[model samples]
Target: MAESDDASDSILPEPIRSVTPLTGPHPDAEMDVIGWGIFLGLMLLLVPLLPFIIVVWLISKLVEALTPS
Candidate 1:
């Protein structure tokens, strides 16, 4: 089992070594833009609603506490 594990580890690095490193704008650039866009969009949409959401959550918690479960 230990020998098999060592063989597998050696083989794994072979594939990694064969792969050419990417050159150019990072492959994640587009994803970064999309992720940031989603984050900013959510912030814009949620910021105004935050107070209302908090108020509703507080009311629910208050009611839950006051009511006999």
Candidate 2:
């Protein structure tokens, strides 16, 4: 038992652990502001692109429908 205990202690010099988790948003106001800004920018950019995409898709469908098969 004593030899086994010494061998285990020698194999590991110290216990490895973390006191805190390394995930999730930081509890900071700046990070929240940046996140909201990025979200809003994405929404604004996508909103304009969506209608143009829809218009182009509708025009293609209209052309396909009008074409004689």
Candidate 3:
């Protein structure tokens, strides 16, 4: 029983550990610029669609208003 316990303990591998610390907080220019450009482009595209969304919303509201509660 003693030998079996020791054998089992030896067979199991040790737990893995890792630690990653930030070395710097500087923003990456290329990634930041690309991300911002994509974000701005999306916003620009969405802005033009705002009026269409408002029209749809208004139509739905008007329909609901015309219908009985």
RMSD value for candidate 2: 7.8
Q: Kindly report which residue stretches of model 1 are placed more than 4 angstroms away from their true locations once superposed.
A: 1-27
Sort the candidates on TM-score, descending order.
1, 3, 2
Tens-digit lDDT track of model 1 for 7-67? 9877744344546777885577888899999999999999999999999999999999999
Model 1 misses residue 1 by how many Å?
31
Query: In TM-score terms, which candidate is top?
Result: 1
- How many clashing pairs per prediction, in order? 0, 0, 0
lDDT of each: 0.90, 0.92, 0.92
Candidate 3, 8-62: lDDT as tens digits: 8889687776697647778689998999999999999999999999999999999
46, model 1: CA deviation in Å? Answer: 0.5
TM, every model: 0.60, 0.42, 0.55
Model 3 has an lDDT value of 0.92
Better of 1 and 3 by lDDT: 3
Instruction: Give the per-residue lDDT digits (tens) of candidate 2, residues 1-69.
Output: 999999987895676889987897558898889999999999999998998999999999999999999
